[model samples]
Target: MRIPVPHWPSVAGRARADAGPLLLAAVVVAVVTLLAGAVPPLVSATADAAVRDAVRGSGADLQVHARMEADDGPGGSRARHPRLAEDVDDFRTRATDELGPGLRAVLRPPVATVISPTLKITDGSVLRTFQLAYLARDGGPAVSWIAGGPPEPTASETAQVPYGAPPWPVQVGLSEADAAALQLRPGARIPLADDQGNVKKAQVSGIFRPQDSADPAWRLVPALLSPVAGADGTGGTRFAGLLSRESLPDARLAFGQDELRRTVRFTPEPARLTWDAVPSVIAKVVALKAASGSSGARDGSLKWETGLDGVLRNVSAQVGAAFAQASVLLLTLLAVAVLVLLLAADLLVRRRAGALAAARQRGMSLPVIGGELLLESAVMALLATAAGLGLALAVAPGVSWQWTAPVVVTAVAAGPAFGTLTAARATRDRRVPANRSARRWLRNTARLRRAAVEAGVLLAATGAAVALYQRGVGGGVLPASAPALCAIAGALLLARALPVGTRLVLRRLLRSRRPLAVFGAARAAAASARVLPLLVLVTAAALASYALTLGAALGHATALGHATALGHATALGHATALGHATALGHATALGHATVDSPLASGLLRLTWVAAVTLPVLGLLGLALGTAAGAPERWQTLTRLRTLGLRPREARWVAAGELLPPVALAAVGGPLLGVLLARLTFGSLALPLLTGADFTPAPPWWALGLVAAVLLAAVAVVVPVESALRRRRRLSEVLRAGDT
Candidate 1:
C-alpha cells in the first residue's frame, strides 16, 4: 500500500496569496538598494568632472615657478653664473625627480628663462624700462617670424660686460605689436642703463608673434607678448625684449649678476590632471616646495611657488560640500523608505490577523508564529536586495560600502522588526476594563510616550542644525544626516499640525446639517491616530515638490543658449567685429565654465537622475501608503453599509478619511520643501554644483501646481480605492472583520 501524501503550501504560494503588501515592501527594498549603489558613484563622477574643470580654468595659476639667482657667490665669494642651456635641463630633471610618478604625468616640460631687472631704454625719445629676457627656445611656445630672424649672440669681443655678456652687444627680438607701438624696427641698436649706472647696448634682431596667444608658455613671461603700461607708476610703459638661448651669455653681463634671475616654470598638463590624482599631486607639490625652500634663504637659493595646491584644495572642499548635500538626499529617501516599510508591515499584519488569531486559539506559540513571519520577511528582503544591488552595479559599477551598508541593513531589518512588533501587539488581550480611571491612565501613558518621541526628534534636529550652521558649506566636510534630521523634524511638526486642523474641520462638520460631511469628518478624526501613514505622505509630498522645483530650476539652467545668455550677446557681437581669431579666443575663454561644458553637463546629468527619480518614487510610495489602509477601511465601510448606509454615503466616508490629510499634505509639502531647500542650499553649495550665479527658487505657480497635482491625485485615488473595495462580497467582509 502507498503512503498518503501531505498537502503543505510552499512559501512562494503563501507570498503570492498575500502579494499586495509583500510586493510593495520588495519594491521599496530594491529601489533603496539600487540608489545606495547608483547615487554615490554618479555624485563622485560629477565631482571629479568639477575638479577637472576647476584645475583647467586655473590656467597659468597651476604653474610651478622656481626662481634661482643666476649669479650667486661661488665656492669662494664670487658672483656665480648659471650655465646657459645646462641649468635648464638640470632643473627639469630635478622637478621630475622630486614629483616622482605621482605628479610627473601632469607636469609639463619646464621652460627656462633668464630675466633682467628694470633698465632704462635709451633708444627712443619716450622714456621706458626694458627687461632683457632670454627664453631657451627648447619647449617654448611656437612663434612665426614677422621680420628678420631669431636673436643671435654678439660677435664683438669688448661687448662682454663684467658679469658674462658676449664680446659684442646683445641682440634681442620683440613682438610685432610691441615693435609697432614702440616705433622700433629690426636691426635698430638700443642702449639700456640700470639703476646702478651699468650701461649696455642691445640690437633688435627680428620681430615675432606667438602662433597661439593663449598658449600658457607665453604666460611664463607675460610682458613679452604684450606691453605693460605704467609698470613702475611712471608715465612710461614696460617691455620685455626676448633673446635666444645663444644670447644668454651676453645677457648675463647686460643685466649684471645681482640683477640676473633665472626661472624654471612648469605648467600642468590639463588632460592628465584628474580628481583621483589631486591629493597625490598636492602632496608632491608640498614636498617639492619643502625640498626647494630648504636650499637657502628666500632669495638666496632656489625658491619654488605655486597656486596648484590651493586650487586643488578648493576643488576638494567643493566636492566634500556636494557629497554632504547628496547624503541629505540619500538619507531623506531612506527615511521615506523606512516609513513606507513600516506602513506595509502594518498592513501585512492586519491582513494576516485572522489566520494568526486562529493559530493562537489552536495553542500555537507566539514565538513560533513570529519566527515563521520573520523567515518570510527575510526571504523577501534578501531577494529584493540582491536584485537591487545587481541592477545598481550594472548601472553605476562601483559600490560605496559606507553608503550601501546602511541601506542594506535597514532593508533587511525593517520588515521583520515591524512584523514582529505588529504581531506582538495583535496577540495581546482585547477584553475591555470597566474602570474609566484605568483607561485614563493608559491615555496619559500614551501621551507621555508621544511627547517623549517628539521631544527627542526636536532635540536631534536642533543639534544637527546647530552643527551644520557652525560648520557652514565652506568650513569643511560635514555629516550627511544633518539635513535629513532637519527635514524629518519639519515633517513631524507638520504632521502634528495636521490633526489639529482636521479636528477643527470635524467641529465644523459637527455643527453642519450634512450627515455625510459629519461622518466623513469623524472618519478623518480617527485617522489622526495613524501618524505613520500621514508622516510618510507629508514627507513624500515635500520631497516630490522639492524634486519638481529642482528639476524646473535645472531645466532653466541647462536650457540651450543659457551659457551665452549672460552678457555674451554683446561679447559675441564684439568678437565678430574684432576678427575671427580674437572672437575665437574670447569664446574659448568665456565658455570655459559654461553650462554646455563637460563640468556642467556632468552635474546636470547626476542631478537630473535625482530630480526625475524622486518624484516617481514619491508617487509610488504614496500609493503604497494609501493602499496599506484599504483593507481596514473597506471592512469599516462594509459594516456601515450593512447598518443601512448607502453606497454613496460609504464613498463619502472614505473621501472624508483621505481628503483632509491629503489636502493638508499637498498644501504643507511645497511650503516645507521650500523651507528645507532654503535651509540646506547654503550649506550644500548648490550654486557651485550647478555652476550658476544664483540659487534656484521655485516660483509660486510651480509650488501651487505641485499642491494641486497632489490633491488631484488623492482625489482620483479615493474613488479608485472605493470602487476596488466594493467588489468584495458581504460574507468575505464579515469573515475578514471577525478575523
Candidate 2:
C-alpha cells in the first residue's frame, strides 16, 4: 500500500461491464446483415422461377427456327446432287456458333425437317390437305407404330421421277389420329397435287404415335401430331403426313427441290435457365438474329426466326419488377433495423453516461473518447457481421453488396455516434439548469432543426412519389424506394401529431377531478419529447401491415391462377398440350403465395420473415426506448410513492405514457399501409409472380389482425417494462444518489 499502486481497470472487468450493450449491438448487426445478405439470392430464385414459368408457357414459340426454301439448281442441269445431311449439319453448326456458348448450353440439338407443299386427299366429298413431313430420326421424339411399320424409299435414281407411267408411290406415315381423320389406313394410296401442279402419289406406310406428346420434339411441328383447321377457306383439316428418313431423295424427285421448305429448330431446355443467364442469352440471341439477317441478305435464302428474344425480354422485365417488390420489404426491414439500432445505442450510451462524464472531468479529450468507443464498437460489430454474413451465405448462397454493406456500416457506426453525442451532453450536465428564457431559446433552436429535417424528409418523399407515379403510369414500374420514403414521411407526420394528441389528453385530464388521471396525462405529455419510439412503432406497424396486405394479395392471385388453370384444363378436357394447369397445380401444392417450382419457395420464406420481423422489431424498439429512461422513471415513481401515490395510480401513469404511441400506431399503421400499397401496386406487377391480377385493397380482416397484434404486443411489453422498473427497491434508488 505504501508503494502507491495505481488502480487501473482490468480488461476482464471492462468486458464484463460492457457485455450487455456489446451483445445487443452484436445481435442487431448480425440480424441486419443476415437479412441483407439473403436478399440477392432470394430475389434471384424468385425471378428464375418466373423465367422458367414463362419459358414453359411459350411452348413451341420458345424455340429458334431457321427456315429456308430449298433451292433448285440453275437451268435444270441436274448434274449436281444435293447432300441433305451435310447441309443440315452445316446449318446446325452455324446456329450454335452464332448463339454463343451460354445460349447453346440450354438448347437441344437442332432438329432438321423437310415439308412438301400442301397436297389434298379427297375422302368421299370431304377433302383433307396435308403436307408430307420428314423429321431427322436422330433428333426427333421416339414414335411407336400403332398399325404398320416405317415407310420405304422410292427406287428412282433421277430427280423428277423420270415422268414414269407406272412408278411406285412415295411411302409416307401419319399419326394414328390424323390418319383416322383423313380416312386413310396402311396401304391406302392417294394422288396428291400442289398449286404448282406438281403431283405425288403417296402410299400410307404406317400409323405411328408419339411416346410423349409433351416432348419438345413435337413442339416445332404440332401439325404432325394433331389435325389443324385450315384457314384456306376449303374447310378442310390440315395434317402433317410423316415420311421416313429414306424418303428424302424420293420426296425431292416427286415434289421438286423448290417446292419444299426445310427448317432447323432448337428447342430451349427450361431446366437449364437461370435469372443471371437471361440477359446474356438475350444478347446472344440478338447477335444470332443479326448474323442470320446479314447472311440471309447476302445469300437471299437463309433466314433465322425466333420468339426467344421477346420471351427473354419479358422475363427481364419481370425480374426488375420482382426486385423492386423485394426492395420495399428489405428497405422496411433496414429502416426499422436502423431505428432499433439507434434506440439500442441510446440505451447503451445512457448506461455509460456517468463514466464518460467522469472521464471528461479527468481531462480526456472528446476525440480520444470517440475514437475509443468507435474501436470498441467496430471490433464487436465486425465479428457479428462476419458471423451473420457467413450464415447468410450458408443459407442462401449470394451476397448483395448494395443492400448488405449499408446495413452493416449503419449498424457499426450507430453505437459510436450515439456514445460520442451522449458523452458530450453528459459532460455539460455539470452546469446549472438554464433560465426560462435560455430554455425557450434552446427549445426554439431544436424545433427549427427538427423542422428542417422533417421538411427535407417531406421533400424527398414527394419527389419519390412523383417519380414512382410517373414511372408506374408511363412504364409500369414503380421506383423501388417509393414505399419506404412515403412510410418515413408518414411516420414523421405521426410523430408530430403524437405531442398534440397527448396535450389534448392532458387538457382534458386537467379538467377532471381525478388526480390520478391528471398525473398520468401530465406524464404522457412530458414523454412526448421521446419521438424515436413513436416513429419506430408507426413505421414498423405500417410495414407489417403492408407486408400482410401483399401476402394476401399474392395468395389471392395465386388462387386465382390455380382456378384459371383448372378452368382451362376442364375446358380443354385435360389436354396434355395445355401444361399451365399442371404448373399451377405444382405451385398450389408448394403454397398459395409462390409461383411454380421449388425455386420460388425463397420468396415466400423471405416475405414471411419480413412480416414477422417488422412487428417484433417495433415492439423491441418501443421497449428499449422506454427502458433507456427507466432509471429516471423509477426514481420519479419512487418520489411519487413517498407522496402517497398508490400502485394503481402508478400503473395508470405507465399506461398513459404508452397509450398515445400505441394507439397512434394502431390507427395510422393500416392507413399508411393502404396508401403505400396503392402507390406500389400499380407497377409491382403482382401478376408476374403468380400469373393473376387481384384487387389492390387491403383485406379488412388482415388489417384488423395486424392492428390487434400490434396493440397486444404493446399492451404486454409496456406492463412488463413497468413491472421491471418497479423491481428496483427504494434503497437501491437512494443508493444511486436520488434526491
Candidate 3:
C-alpha cells in the first residue's frame, strides 16, 4: 500500500523519543571529540618560550657541558679518527676566529666551581686541605637558585685536594643549577684563593637566583644577598655566588646573537705595507699570538666562532622543520579519519532503510522522514567534532584556535549534507523494486568476497616479512612488517594464494545457533573477512621503513659523539681538563706546553650541542592527530556490550580518541597557528616548506589508523544498534515456506 505521508509535527513526538536522545548524544560526542584538539597551540607556545629561555648562552652552539677521556694510553697513543678535523694543520688556519660574522654575542657561561674543605673526618681520619677553585666567585647571574633560610658565614676549612696545583690561581663558585646537580645541599664550601697551597675555604652561603629578564639579573647582587664578609666585614668564612662583570661594559656592546667579545691585546702590523685596507685579521691575530710568546700560546687555539646568530636561525629552523613535518602528517591523517567516519555514516543510513520504510507507513513525507533519519547523523558528527576539540584543549592548554569562517561553515554545512545523503539513500532504497533485491544481495556478497581476498594478500605479505626477519635479511628495518613489493607481486601471481585460514576461522565463529548474535557474527565476519587482507598488510612490518630510517639516523648521531670524544683525547697527552675538571683547578695554569700529537688510531664519534635537544619530545607528542574511527567505533561497541560502564567507556575513548583528537589536530595545530602569530608569523612561514613535505606519508599512515579507530566506532556503534533492531526486518525479507 502507498501509505499517506504526514507532516513534521505529526510524528515529531515519536521520532524525538526514539532518535532525539541519540542525536543529542551525537552532538555532545562531536563537541567533545572536536574539543580534544583545542589546546595544543598554547602548550607549544609555553614550551617554545621555555626552551628559548633556557638556551641562555651563545656558546650553547658548540658547548658540551662536560667530557672525560683516558689519556697516555699504551705508548702514549690516543684513539682518533683521521678524517676528523682534530690534528689538521690546515684546520688551524681555517678555524681562526677572524670571521666578521662571529662578532655578535658573547655570553660566557659559569667558568666552573671550586670546593675547599677546612675540616673533613672521613673513615675516622681528619684531613685539612686548601681547595682548587674556578672563577665562580661574584659571577653574573647565569643560573638561578630556589632557597629558603640562609647560609653559614664561615666554613670548617677542611678540603680534600683531589687535583689542584699549589698556589691555585682563579676559581669560580658553583652555579645554583650546578650546585643542585651535585646534590651538595647548601653549606658546601668552594675553595677560594690564588695560592693552591693555602687555598682559602669559602662556604656556600647561597646560590644566585636569576629572573627571566636581564634587568633583574643585572640588578641581582649575589654577594649582597649572601654577604660573605657580612656587613661588618669580620666574618672568618663566608660564601657568595659572584658574577665577574668587569667585562660588562665590554660585554654590553660585544654580546651579539651568537658571538662573544674577546679582548685581544695584540694585532700584528703588516711587515710589507699594501694599500689593501682590510687587514688580514686572522693573520694579524696569529702573528700577535706568536709575539705574545708563551703567555698568548698558553691560551691556545682561540677560534672566534662568530656568526652564531645566523647559525641559530638555521639550527632552530632545522629542528622546527623536522618536528613540524611529523605534525603535518598526523593532522592530515586525522582529517582523513573524520572523512572516513562520515563515509561509514552514509553507509549506515543505507543499512537502516527498513526503519524508514516502517516510518513512511505511519504517514511521513520524505522530508519528514529525513528529519527523523538525519537526527542521528547531525548528532554524531557534531558530537565527535566537539569531543575532539574538548580533548585537545583540556590536554594542551594555550591552544590558539583559529575559528576560520570557512572551516566552521564547512563543518556546519557537512551536517545537513550528511543528513540529506543518508536520508535520500535510505528513502530511495526502501522503495527499490522487488526485482533489484537479488542484485543488492549479490553485490553485498561480492563485497565480502573481495574483502576476504584482500585479507589473504595481507597475510601472505606478512608471512614473507616474518621469514625475512627470522633470517636477518633486513636490519630490523622491516621488523615491523616491511614489504618486498616484488615478493608480494609473486604471491599475487600464485592464483590460489589467498588467506584460506582466516576464512575457516570466520566460518567456524559465525556458526552460532542464536539469531541476533549469529547474525551479527555473520555480518561482521563477512565485513571483517574481506578486511583481513588489508589488516594483514597493515602489520608492524609495513612501518619498518620509518623505524629503519630514523634508527639509522640516530645511530649516525651516536657515532658523531664518539668521534668528538676521540678528537679531544688525541689533542692533549691526556684527555684535556674538561668543564667538569675546571672546578677542581684553583691556581694559575703553568707555562705553554706544546706537544705535537699524532693521530694514533681512529675512533669514530661526533659532538652534539644539548641546549635545544628536548624540543623533540613535544614533536613526538603532537604527531597523533590522525587515527581510524573504526577502532574507536569497534571499541565503543565492545564497551557497550560490556555493560557500558562510564569509566570503561572513558578509558576506551581516551586510548582510542585522545591521540589524534587531543595532541595533533587540536594541540599541535593550535600551537602551530598560535606560534606563527605570536612571533610575527615566523612559525607559519616554515609550514610552507620542504620539511613539511617530507613527513607527509608516515603522518598520513598513522593519522588514518587513528581516525579510522575513532570514526569507525561511531559508525559501527550506530550500525550495530540498528542491527540489533533488525529481527523484524530480517523476518519480513525472508521467503515464505509452505507445508
Candidate 4:
C-alpha cells in the first residue's frame, strides 16, 4: 500500500507540523550514538599509555642478571664460584634465542669498580673522599646522562670522553656536582687513591649528570665522585662517574681484579617498548620459562625477573573494569534517550491524531498510515545516525571500527523502531462509551497491571545488583546492566508515584481562596498528558545528581593521594640530606610517590567530564519534552483568558501548573539519585575511595542549578507560547478547533 501522490503533500504538511518533536527525537539518537562510538577506543588508548609509562618508570620489564653461585661437591663441600662472563653470555644467548624478535634491546656493562677516591686540589687541600664508578661500555652512560651530553669518541674506537676534549693520557669523567666540588674542568689532572692504596693520576675528561637520585634510572648511570666542603657530620658527598672501555684495565689494576669482579656484574636492561608490544614480550618470557626447566633457572642458577607480565595483566584488567563502568553509564544514557524519544514521538502522534482519524474516515487503511509514519521515522533515524557518526569522528579521530559498528546499528535501529511503535500505539482507534466516566480510566486492574510491571522490573534490577556485588567481591569488571537496571526501575517506580502525589497536593490547594492556586489545581487534575514529561525530568535530575556526587568524592580522594605522596617524598629528601645511613628509607619514600601520578589524574578528569556532560544532555531532552506540550497548554490559557482571566493572571496560573511537578522532582529526584549511588558504592567496592576518608556529598548546588534552569524554561516557554496564542485572537483558535 502506498501513500497516494495527491495526498503525499497533505501527509508531508502534517509531518512538518510535527517537526519540533521529531527533531528532538533525532537529537537524542545523535547524542547516544556519538558517545557510544567515541568513548571505548579513547579509553583503551589512554589505559595502554598509562600502563606503558608505569612499566617504564618502574623498570619492571624483562631483565637478565648474572650472580655467582658456589658449586658443591658430592659431600656438600664448596668447590668453586661460577664463571661470571661465561655464564652471562650463555644466558643472554639462550634468552635471545627464546624471545627472538620480541626482544627490544639488551644492555651489558663491562667489568668495572665503584671506589672511594680523594681528589688532590690545586690549592694543596684535599676536597675529601667520595665514591666513583666507571663504566667500560660506550652506550651505558648515554642512557642516563642529563647534562653535558654523552661521552664523545677519541681517534681510536677504544676510548670516549667529554665532547671536544683532547685525548687525555688517562681519561676520566666527573659528575657535574663532583666537577663543581673540586673546581675541576675537563683536561685537569687529578690523583685518585682507591681503598687498596693504589694511586692513579687521571685527567678529568667530561662532566655528566644523573637523573633525580630517587629515579630507578639513576641507578643505571655511573655517578661522578665528589666531596662536600661542609658535610652533615658523617662524611662528604659521593658521586659516580663513567669511563670508556679503554679505561677498564686501569680500574682493574687500581681496584684489584677480585674486588672489581665482586662489585661489578653484567645485567640486561630492556629498552622502552610501546604498550602494544608489552603482551608479546610477556608471552615470550613465559615461553622462555617453560622451555628452560621445572626450576626455570637461567645460567649459573641465577633468577630471571620481569614484572612486565603482571603489569600488563593488571593494566588489561583495569581497562576492562573501567570500560565496564563506562558501559553502565552508556546504557543509562541510552535508556534515557529512548524514553525521551518515545515520549516525543507519542506527543507528535497525538498532535496528528485528528488528521489520522479523518484519513481513516475517508477510507485510508491503518497499514498505509503506519507505513507512511514508519518511512518518515526511518528517514529521520538515518539522518540522525549520519550526524552522530560525523560528530564521533570529529571528537575522537582514532576511534576503531570495533567501537563504531555496534553503536551505528543501535542508532539506526532504535530510533525508527521506537518512533513507529509509539505512533502505532497512539493512533490505535478505540470506541468511547457514550457515558464514560473518569473513574473508568482509573480502574483497579489498570493500576495493578502497572504496579506488577514496575515490580517485575524492580525485582530484575535487584537480581542484577546482587550479581554485580558478587562480581565486585571476586574482583573483576562489574556488569553494565547493574546500575542501568537500577536507574530504570527507580524511574518506573517514580513515574507511578509522582502523579498520584501531585494530585493529592493539588487537591488540597483547590480549597484555597487564591485564584491562581484553584486554576492551577484544576488544570493539573485535567493534565494527565503531562505525566511522561515529568517522569523524564525527574530521571534526568536523579542521574545528574548521582554523577556529580561521585565525581566530587573521587576528585577529593585523588587530590589527597597526590598530597600524601608528595609529603613522603619531602620527608625522604630531608632524611637523605641529614647523612643518615638510610638508602632503604629513601626507596620506601619513593615507592609511595607512584600511587597517584599524572596519568591517573587525567583519567579521573575524563570520568568527571563525562559524568557532568551526560546529565546536561538529559536536561536538554527534558526541556524539549516540556516544550512539546506547549500548544495544548497555550490553548487552555487562551480559553481561560476569554473567560475574563487577565493576561498576568493566566501567566501566574501557567507558572503554578508547572512549578509543583518541577519542585517535587527537584527535591525527590536527587534524593533518589543519592540513594542509588550509595547502593552502587557499597556493591562495587570502588577503589577510588578505598583507603581514603571521604564521604559522598550530595550535590545540592547542582540540584539547585537544575531546578533553576527548569523553572526558567517553564517561565520562558509558557509565557512565549501563551502570548503567541493571544496575538492570534480567540476567534481563530475556536475556528481551528484543536486541529
Q: Per TM-score, what order, best first? A: 2, 1, 4, 3
Residue 9 local lDDT, model 2: 55
Provide TM-scores for the models. Answer: 0.78, 0.83, 0.35, 0.74
- Candidate 2 per-residue lDDT, tens place, 410-445, comes to 667877787678768766745534698887888799
How many clashes in each structure? 5, 0, 140, 6
Q: Best candidate per lDDT, number? A: 2
Q: Model 4: how far is 175 from its true place, Å? A: 8.0
Tens-digit per-residue lDDT, 1-739, candidate 4:
5544335676588669877777876776677667766766566556555555445444443544433343333443322222333443455554444456545343333333334243323334534554445432223334344344333332343222332233133456777777787777777766555545445556666776544444333343323433443233344444445554444334433332234422233333434444466577668667655544323343343344555566556554544555565555555566556666656665666667666666766666556666566667777777887787788878874544443344344434543454445445544675555555755765756778777877887898888788777775224223456665676677677666766866886778767778778887766655543556766767776776766666676667656765665566677666565443244344333332342343345445555665565566656655665566566666777788789999889888777677666665676667777887787765443353222446677667876776676666677766776666667767766566563
TM-score of candidate 3 to 2 decimals: 0.35
543-639 per-residue lDDT for model 1 (tens digits): 7556555556655654533454435545664545333234334443443344134444554454455545555555665676677677767677888
What is the Cα-based TM-score of model 1?
A: 0.78
Of the two candidates 3 and 4, the one with more favorable lDDT, higher being better, is 4
Model 2 poorest ten-residue lDDT run: 591-600
The lDDT for every candidate, in the order shown, is 0.67, 0.70, 0.32, 0.56
lDDT of 3 at 199: 38
For model 4, the superposed segments whose C-alpha errors exceed 4 Å read 1-15, 67-91, 103-219, 224-302, 309-321, 360-368, 400-445, 473-478, 528-530, 573-600, 607-615, 682-693, 735-739
Candidate ranking (lDDT, best to worst) = 2, 1, 4, 3
What range of 10 consecutive residues in model 1 has the weakest lDDT sum? 2-11
